[model samples]
Target: MTGPAQNALYAALFGDPQTEALFSAQAELAAMARVEAALAVAQSQLGVIPADAGPAIAAACTALPIDPQDLTQATAQNGVPVPGLIAAIRDRMGRTPHAAHLHWGATSQDIMDSALALRIGPILALWEGRLHAILTRLAGLAADHADLPMAARTYGQAATPTGFGAVVAGWGWPLLDQVQAMPALRDRVLRVSLSGAAGTLSAMGPQGPAVRQAMARALDLGDPERSWHSDRSGPGHLADWIAGLAAALGKLAEDLLLMTQSGIGTVVIAGGGASSTMPQKRNPVGPSAMVALARHAMGLAATFRAAGLHRQQRDGAAWFTEWLTLPPLCIAGGALLRTADDVLERLTPDAGAMARDLQIGQGTIHAEALTFALTEHTALDRATAAARVADLCAQALREGRDLTELARGAWPGPDWPALIRARSLGQAPQEARAFDRAVRAASGGLDQGGS
Candidate 1:
């Protein structure tokens, strides 16, 4: 799973290597050990476990001198790794009373859950940085292309004129919202889990709440008011948020695929895929990877919903199912975010091709503009005037004369220059700049300040 040829995804295109390593077997074990150490210290502070035992146990977890192969074998036998991990740490400590106090009050779920939260906090921060980069790049694109005209389409046919910057803003806002939401999402999802045996921390006595709170402080995680042994809301929301983000990126990828097509060519991507046999084909490879990853996330979101159906307090079946679902979701999300940022950096909109697309309708593209201009002289309302001008433009296309020529013949007062030039960019430039301002606000104006 680590190498390119073996797993391909974690090493190749679909997973970020840094984030991938964060969820690796060694990382997971180490994190679990950290959680165990924190629990020991927290128990010692509350007088639930001996003070001398806490230092030795914490040191063992910190050093992680236990062998990986032994832990793996024990995990297979015990159905979870913490029992084996604890045995190894205790054996390494080598004393009856000192080793006896190791992991006195915590359960396997507590270690695993808290360890996952520890890993996730860092992962979410990684995404926040990546998302900030995206917002910065997108804002620049919006501002630079605020006036760049492109033919707008409805139902895959030319509808009117619009600026590409405005379209980019639509993409920017969803990502902005996601970025804005990260802090709260992390707070909610990265809570420390310290419930023992069952939902209640019965083994830790009445100081259970304080010990849990102390552990939360030790790990820099949110201290839940109650143990979330059965409550899957936090993890579910994180998955949903990531899935929504991937879905938004998928929308962008869909447009990128369409705009980069052979005939359309409204977009130019720097690094595209090559066809094996067809030397002329340069495929939209990045967006294609994005589409595949997004689809994977969307599909996993459904499985997560089913996985969250915990059968009462602590369904080992349901919890194990999450083990199968969430890590891949994280991998896909991390990879997609990176790919999207790269795609944005490498993408170039073909201003010339966009202008040419406007001409494909052969002046019929300006019918809406013409129709509005005709409203001044004629007694016709907008709909009637639009239909009247549309007819002339359609007939002109068939007869090979210009729309302006036909419009002047029929309506007499239409302003040819103003009407034919792309119109109704109404508020588009302002909207683009507004998105830039929002980015500045999020970054505390540092990203584009004094520029």
Candidate 2:
């Protein structure tokens, strides 16, 4: 019911404690202070500010010399928290000669955006770690179940027989792509923003480019080489990537939901939610949460992309829209990944249940395999074989008998049981092992070390 990761009621369900702290108000204040300190140092080194002022500001920032509560009212009046933060830093260094050089020529957007990059550095690392963990688990699952036969469903109906490993591979392939894209995303999105008042370093004069590059070095971020005050592509790209990751997790959740349905219990998730009145209920709570979180991230991502319409040099309305949406979108993505890792760790496939569902419609699941066998092993043409197979499938359904049993009466040439077993899992095992191989190649090994 509540918004924001700090919501006491839904924090655990929809927010990741670690990532939430990274986006908290106090953390934001500290990050902005770090940006200010780094900017002062960079400008001082470039002879744009007093050298003593740089060291003094750095010391004040290291001390984090301000109360976050004091900025609430000031931020309401100033429209951005950077001004309040700067004023607080000045107050903390009263009577100090170097305090005058605290902010130097940098603008509010520079500090805030650079601070966001600072916090995002560690957040990206955390997300990559979680992503690698999930991939490792999925690779194991695929390898183990590569030969385990199960019915593959399409449009809510059994379409063909596939190994459970192939099903697992389907869930992990997109994740593999996400992990691979992390390096580029980090490089492009995590950069310094050092534009002056109007996308030009007019205040810093001729030394602006050097100052920005020095600040980038001081803060361990990439130099954008130009102002991004009016260009929201970095944030837009970040939102798109987060939404994509959420969608991947959502697909996995949806599949788990169907697999755990009552009549088709192919997967059993541990620690499912219990019904208040129903005694024998084990609800798929984790998967359900992931699905909901994915939807939330998707909606926020659309809004964030729309907010990229930065008008002229700057647009307060569009900027404020990002402030409203980006934090929750990031939180939702983190929570989805956390939930997926937990769900995968606790998941157990029910081979018996899968086998039972494979024959749900009187062995009609083998219709494709039967048709293929007739053409390949006998003199029957493709059309004749298909029609004959369809006819036998109808007879088996009408009489409530196995299709293979009826096929024996129709075609006695091919070894029916062997043919069914051979064709039931066409390339499914290969597909699963191929995924495992890819994970191993990408990760160096399956030891869950790094991405």
Candidate 3:
């Protein structure tokens, strides 16, 4: 029997190429290269090695080619890349004792951490692009449907009337806020880890600081004041950020799922599934996928958070869990963004149904505003006007008359006609427009950054 087909991600991360080339996998490899070079350079500068050897070490480290399969096999046996990588470099450099300076003051965690930062740089770029596309699509949908009226649901029951734009805006604003915070969050994830052996660079003497600074410059990462060998705050914070993004998408997906329900029939989309069993059913594919993707994201995010609870020095179990968690989280987020873009792009507004549902509550949806308007022309207080409107609604329900006619006869208010006519909407359009502008502006900035 054949084994399962290899996934692209697995091949990229574990393949035999000198470079992984894929964003996440390459990050780990790049970090390793940078740390190795920096350690050699630091040793030469501090007079621990021949000055001429520094340039040779840097050149060899960058250009050296090793069998990826060999590294993989070594990792499987020893659970780390340093052992195999060291052997490969020694082989390339021959039997010269100078090769000993290749990894002079560094440890396994240093290279691994650097690799993680390299991976984050590219992953963040991908995430930013997905976010911009999703936000831009949502803005367009909101703008096009700004004045389109729809039922406002509270607790799964129709409570009032609102515009479709407002509903979309509610989802867009919070997501935009998250986009604005991404750069800082990325910085937190890009910090460099350079402490050797234990939490201190004691093996490198006083030159550790200069070497660390040079390493940070070479890799475009920040240097923490000291080693964070056991502190998992950076990884934990990143996990939380990802989880928050998933939650936002999940909320949007939940709304689309409900709005597209057959019973509600408030929202319509093109190219949804046609049931195989029943030839007549048009399934809401976009919303359904959105819901599924969001759920998957939530589960992976939970795993990422759980992986942060490792005890000091580094728990292999918890650290290894990240290998399982981060990739799925990234993939799920990408899928959700893609699905949301498709869903919003093809969404069709049902103006007639929205108008009809507004009257389902016996015009109670418009009653609150009408009551406030009536108080201006009559001696009755705000509460009295509200009571009068309630009475008219009850009578209309019993007598089968329009609320507008009942209000005119029973309340004798001058503004009753205009107030009743304006009841089918609220602040939804204005909110949608404002949200659209914000989303476009944010997306513009992200696009400028090539996200």
Candidate 4:
């Protein structure tokens, strides 16, 4: 309850249940046990332990009834849960001949890190599912509103006209890149760690590398070939990926936050939060939470990266820092993705309000279109045409008239509506549909390790 992610009051708002469960103490213990079992079997297969010991150790690891609560005091004393875990497993084996072979030549870091890698496989799988759902929803949004015109803003002011589809696509391209990078990321980060003690398997002598490879194959993980005891790059890469995903989702949330403002209500979010004091308030709760979670991820990512500064062969301080930072960082990322998917599911674009805002500044949004038409169809140069349009825009604002009308009065030969339409949403529709196509093509590969 001390952690906001698991706190009863805040869990629904900020926590991701699946992510929490994966990183939970019980889950960690199970993963560690799995690692131990794999290590035992691998050692036995490589002749480092007795042939009969492997199955016995594996069975014990699977069937041992070691509660996580029983390991807390030991974990606090030993700086890791593996010692207590192995002890509990050995005790459960009860002086059996194979009990001595359990966790042989393996350090606590080996079990712990390998267990984390095991858990990461399912976590990545979860992310793949979420990404597929999110991209599908976003593609639908883009296709549905491919030509729906809206005022595009820059620097907190309306700049020009754009389609809502393009705006949605902007939020999707980064995520698509993330999806594409999943395979490489998994290869880089989801590797087995089997460095014994000071990263050299001295106890197992020459068969150590073989044992490590066997364990990696048994656990369906990548083998780094060298010990990563002092190399924290794997975890660092994961933190970076999580932060990047959060930032991408945050960008969408920030745009939605602006679009849903009181007077500039271009996007309507259904099921907005009700303000207790205000009778007419529909606060953007999901976007707000996404933004907050994204910012939290940013800070946690920095700390996580710093934890990569491990000293020499092993640094308990840096390792402990990672334990403190990674779980919450991962949870925040999951919540952000979950919230973004939910928000996109309920989002509705207000065409009427968008139209109102498009013409809010006396049709000045079309000034760029007017300037381009003046240059293309007329004799004026680019600078001259731009200046002339600027004058017309000022006149339109001063006289409270439409810039289009004034521009047409000055230059009548060009087809105004056709010209404006051609220039306003130049590549927005195409861009949106391109994203839709990309997502569709990648859909089949998303679950298969991003191909």
**In candidate 4, what are the lDDT values of residues 1-451, reduced to their tens digit?**
2488899999999999998899988888899999999999988888999998998999988956777889989999999988899889988889787888888998999999989998988888888789889999999899889999999988988899999999999999999989888888999889999989899999999999999999999999999999999899998989999999988999999999999999999999999999989989999999999999999999999999999989999999999999999899989989888888899899999999999999998999988887888888999999999999999989999999988888779988777768888889989999899989989989967555564
In candidate 1, stretches whose alpha carbon ends up further than 4 angstroms from where it belongs are: 1-10, 420-422, 445-451
Least lDDT summed over 10 consecutive residues: which range in candidate 2? 442-451
Kindly report which residue pairs in candidate 4 clash with one another: none
Compared with the true structure, what per-residue lDDT tens digits does model 2 show for residues 1-451?
A: 1474568887778889888888888889989999998999888888898877788888888868577888989888988999899888888888888888888878898898999999988988889889988999999999999999999988988888999999999999999999888878988888999989899899999999999999999889999899999899998989999999988999999999999999999999989999999989999999999999999999999999999999999899999999988888888989999999999999989999989989898888888988888888899999999898899888998999999999887777667978989878999999999999998898873255543
lDDT (10s digit) by residue, model 3, range 1-451: 0111125553322121211233343345545766677767767876767786777777777856765666888888877877788777778778777787888778887888777777767766766776777788878878999998787888887766788888888888878877888878876788888888887888878878777877777778888868876777787777777677777877887887787777676778888788889987888876776676677767877888888787877777887787667666666666566667767778877887777777775666667667877776678899888888888878877887777777778766475768645745767789999999998777777667724
Give the better candidate number (1 or 2) by lDDT. 2
Model 3 C-alpha lDDT versus the unseen true structure? 0.73
Among these predictions, the greatest TM-score belongs to 4
- Backbone clash tally for model 1? 0
Q: Each model's TM-score?
A: 0.94, 0.97, 0.86, 0.97
Identify the runs in model 2 with alpha carbons over 4 angstroms from their true place: 1-5, 445-451
lDDT of each: 0.83, 0.89, 0.73, 0.90
RMSD of each: 2.7, 1.7, 4.5, 1.4
Candidate achieving higher lDDT, 3 or 4: 4
Error of 2 at 212 (Å): 0.8
Measured by lDDT, the strongest candidate is: 4
For candidate 1, the 10 contiguous residues with the lowest summed lDDT are: 1-10
